[model samples]
Every structure is written in C-alpha cells, then in structure tokens.
Target: MLQKTYDSQICSLARALELVGERWSLLIVRDALFAGVTRFNDFQHNLGIATNVLASRLEAFVDAGIMERREVHGSPRQHTYALTAKGRDLAPTLVALTSWGDRWATDGEPPILFHHADCGAAVGVETTCARCGAVGHDGVQVAPGPGMPAEYLADRRPARPPQP
Candidate 1:
C-alpha cells in the first residue's frame, strides 16, 4: 500500500497527481491526444464510455486546460476536443508509464506490437529523441520552474555547517 502524504507538505508530487490521479482522466487525454479522438461521439464510441460520464470528464479536462473544444463542421453547437500544448507535453509521462507497464505487466511476449511506419520494424515502448539520440530513463529530466520555492530547494539540500 502507498503511504499517504498531505498535499500541502508533499506539494510537488501531490500537485502532479492531483492533475492526473483521477480515474479515466489521463486515459481520456491519451485517447484524445494520441488516439485522435476528436468528437464527443468518437470518445464515447471508441472508449465505450457512458454518455453522462464522458461529458463530465470532457468538461473537467476542458476546465483544467488540458484540451479545448472547437466547433467542427457538423454542428455549430457541437464541439470537438483537441489536445492543447499542455496536454501534448504529457506524451513523455505517458510513454514512461507505458514502458514500465510493458516491462513488468507483460507475459513473455507482448500481446500488442507497435511498428515503426518508416522502417516497418517492431519497436518496444521507449522514448527516443530524434535530435539528441539520447536513450534510457536517465536521459529524461525535469527542472523546477520559476514557480518553485526557494524554501523547498533549501529543505531538499540544506547548506552545511561551516568547518572549523
């Protein structure tokens, strides 16, 4: 079982989980961002989500700025969900989680295979940057932004006492 931490004290990781921890929330984003689920009907049909639940989740996503609703050709009142930049940035997180799941959760063989369209070679779930060619988990890192607190940094790495 996971140990519980208060949100105020364990602010950073808690903040991340607060955004993504809800059930079916990240999956909804995954479907929209990677699977190309555009319309309300598409999300419901592709995911087999109940109509009311799907609508509520979509609204929550929109409110969180992960996705935006845009008017498609079909109906002026109807809108299609599209991933915003914030949502697109989550690809790496999803990729890492997918890699972990593939490694630990799989039987001897992968039931589902992903192929590289260009090379036609089967690709295991891994994040590779075309520009840098950096591979493996250590290659990925995130720096705290301006919003991060100096106190938090100090707590993490306090200055040592002066030597005699």
Candidate 2:
C-alpha cells in the first residue's frame, strides 16, 4: 500500500498518482470509461473486487471530482456512478497504457482495439509538439513551467529526456 505522500515532490504527475495511482483505481476508471459500468454491483462483478475496497475507491473518486454519485430515482439507497469530464479525460491515458501493455507486456496480438467513434478508424495516441508538429517524445524537452517553483528547478534538471 502507498502509505506515504510525495509532498516534497513538485510535480503534476505525482499529484495525479496520488489521486489514481492504485492499480484497482485505474482499472475501475477504465471499466467505467470503456465498458460503461455505472452501478456499484456492476463494478464489483466486473472487477471481482472486494466490496470494502470498491467502496473506498468510489468514495475517493467522488471526493476528487473524478466521478459523480447519483441517486437512482426509484430505488432506496441505490445510486449510479458517472464519470465527470475530468474522469472521462482519463480515456486517452488508459488507451495509451493499454496500447503499451499490448506491445511490451503481452505475448500475443492485442485482444482489444480502440477506434475513432466518428470515422471508425483505428486510434492511437502520441506526443506531439505544437510549434513544429514533431511526433513522439524525442523532440520533447523539460524546463521550468509557470507552475514550477523557480528555486526548485533553478538547480535541478531532468536526468534524461522524457520518453512520454
């Protein structure tokens, strides 16, 4: 379990990890986003996760503004979990991670495919430069951004260029 905090770290990725860093949290979000799972029981069944753990993750997600828990009109104490815009925004991350897993982690061909909903074309993700339109991470560089504390970055730099 991740019991400690990355409070000393001044990075957005660290913050993101704090929110959805757990394997099951990401899996739950993936099912909610891709498989349209909305109910607690559905998530429990699909993921085969313990009720307590699922409940905690769902609560955390709701608190983080990632998902909204809505009461079902006709049922008592029944609700549906819906991904907010912020939660749906994780789709690309899941897709890219899935692609990477298929390529490097799996032994066989991809078992699933992601396609463009509008044109039905196969979809893929990549990092691109806005100015030169350069594709991939090779052209990427890390420097002080507006959010980074100047002193922190003044004497520190990335050990290697980012591959993502």
Candidate 3:
C-alpha cells in the first residue's frame, strides 16, 4: 500500500484525489462500472485483490458516498455494492484515463475500445472548449481560479511550448 499524501491545496482536483488516490481505489471503481461487479467475492475473484485490501477499499468507498452496500435478503454474509450517482459521474474520467493509456502506453492497436451501446459507434475522449468547440489537448489553457492556493500562484510553470 502506498502512503497517502496530504495536500493543503484548495483545488478540486486535489480534493478528488484525496478520496481516490489509492492504487486499488479507481480500479475497483472501474470494475464496478465496466464489469458490473458487485459482490465482495466477485471483486476478489476478478481483481485478485487481497481480502483485507478489498474490504478497506470498499469501506472507504462507502464512507465517501461513492457506493452503497445492501445486504442480500436471505443471506447473512452476502452483500452487494452499487454505485451511487456521484460514483457514476466518474465514468467519463475513467474513459479519459483509459483513452490516454491506450494512446501512450500501448504498442499497437488498443486491446479494448469503447463504443455506444445504442448505435454501436466507437467513441473517443477529448477535451473540448465549450465556447468555440475547439478540441484536443492544445486548445485549452489553465488560469488561476478563485479557489487556487496562493502557493500555487507564486510557483506556477511557464506556458507550455507548442508540441511539435
């Protein structure tokens, strides 16, 4: 297990990371979203995660309001975990991360592709400007928002050089 880092930063990204930064956390979420896994045994079987680790992750998820646990009606030891609305909102984030891995980490064609189930069209993830509809990584810039910490403002990077 990796030691948790505490950031005194006020950024939303930082806060979000505090909850999901653990190594197995987001992978667990990914399994729940993409593989429809719910039971503890299923998560254990599919992920091969240690029992204590899985239990800790599940308990953290439940505490964070990302997932809700329900007891099996007739079973004492069986429970199902389901994503709450807040958890479902992470689908796009997972898609974005997966797309990044597919592009930069793969040797050839991607092993898996995402598609719309309704129309069966392949889907790609990109950041788009809401104002101009300009797409891709280069079209956006980050500015200091109201919530930005003063330390960050004082020690910011120069504007990135254009990609070749």
Candidate 4:
C-alpha cells in the first residue's frame, strides 16, 4: 500500500482518478479502445456525456499522456483521439478490473462472457511473471520504473521537505 501522507494520498488517488475515477473517463477509454468510437460527436452520441464534461475529460486525458490528439482531414477542422503507448499499457488494468466487476458485481452469472476467439472456450484471467514462473499474489510486486517520480531516485535523501 502507498504511504499515508496527505499529499501522497491525494496525489495517488488524483493520478488514478484522472483516468478511472471520474464519471465518464473509464467509459471514454472503453469506448475509444474497445468500441472503436473516436470522434467527439460519436462519443457524445454513444455515451451521452455532456459536451463540456467530455471536452474537459479529453483534454485531461491528453495532458496525462493517455491519449493523443490528431488532425482529422476533410472535416471542419476537428481532431481525433488516439491512445498513447502509456495509455495502451492500461489494457491489463482495465481487463482485471472488468473481470473483477463481472465476478462480484453482477447478481447471477457474468452478464458478458469473454471467449478465446480462436479456440472458442471460456477463459479465466491470470497474471504471471514472464521472468519467473511463479503464479501467486506474492509473485507480483510493483516497483517504480523510468516513469516514476524524481523523488524515487535512489541517491535522493529521505525525510525531504513536505510538498504543497
């Protein structure tokens, strides 16, 4: 678990909230990626998210490196949204969350079932380390990588000044 400093708590949640915690953000990611709806009008028509809110969410998503804006030719000077590599990395997170929701939230069975398109069998999801064959929760631990915050630098001093 993350440390309980006020700033850490707020920042941690805010970072994730920018993607999934908002009213329509995850749905936006879902539609853009899975449903193949790209245009502003298509999202509006499909999700019914208010115009202003959708605009704000799109801008936020772009700023967070989750989506990129690209020019749309032969149109009235509008742009389209595309996923970034970092954004595409969220695929596993989305899939795990969706699977958990399918298991626990639905009343009877999962309303939707995911099958292997090639083999045509019901599938269960699991996470395994490619480096090691261990297949348990203890086998998985998160460590900061190149994208981590500057304070994560090993040479940095501990008990640093509080952030605002």
Worst 10 residues of 3 by lDDT: 1-10
Cα displacement (Å) at residue 125, model 2: 0.5
TM-score of every prediction relative to native:
0.66, 0.90, 0.84, 0.67
Q: What lDDT is reached at residue 118 by model 2?
A: 98
Off-target runs (Cα >4 Å) in candidate 1 are: 1-6, 112-164
What lDDT does the true structure give each of the candidates? 0.75, 0.90, 0.86, 0.75
Candidate 3 collision pairs: none
Tens digits of per-residue lDDT for model 2 on 17-39? Answer: 98899769999999999899999
Candidates 1 and 3 compared: the better one by TM-score is 3
As for TM-score, the candidate ahead, 2 or 4, is 2
Q: Is candidate 2 or candidate 3 better by lDDT?
A: 2
Question: Which scores greater on lDDT, model 1 or model 4?
Answer: 4
lDDT of 3 at 129: 74
What are the root-mean-square deviations of the candidates from the true structure over C-alphas? 6.0, 2.8, 3.0, 7.1
Q: Could you tell me the lDDT of residue 158 within candidate 3?
A: 64
Backbone clash count for every predicted candidate, in the order shown: 0, 0, 0, 0
Model 1: how large is the Cα RMSD against the reference?
6.0
Estimate the lDDT of model 1.
Answer: 0.75
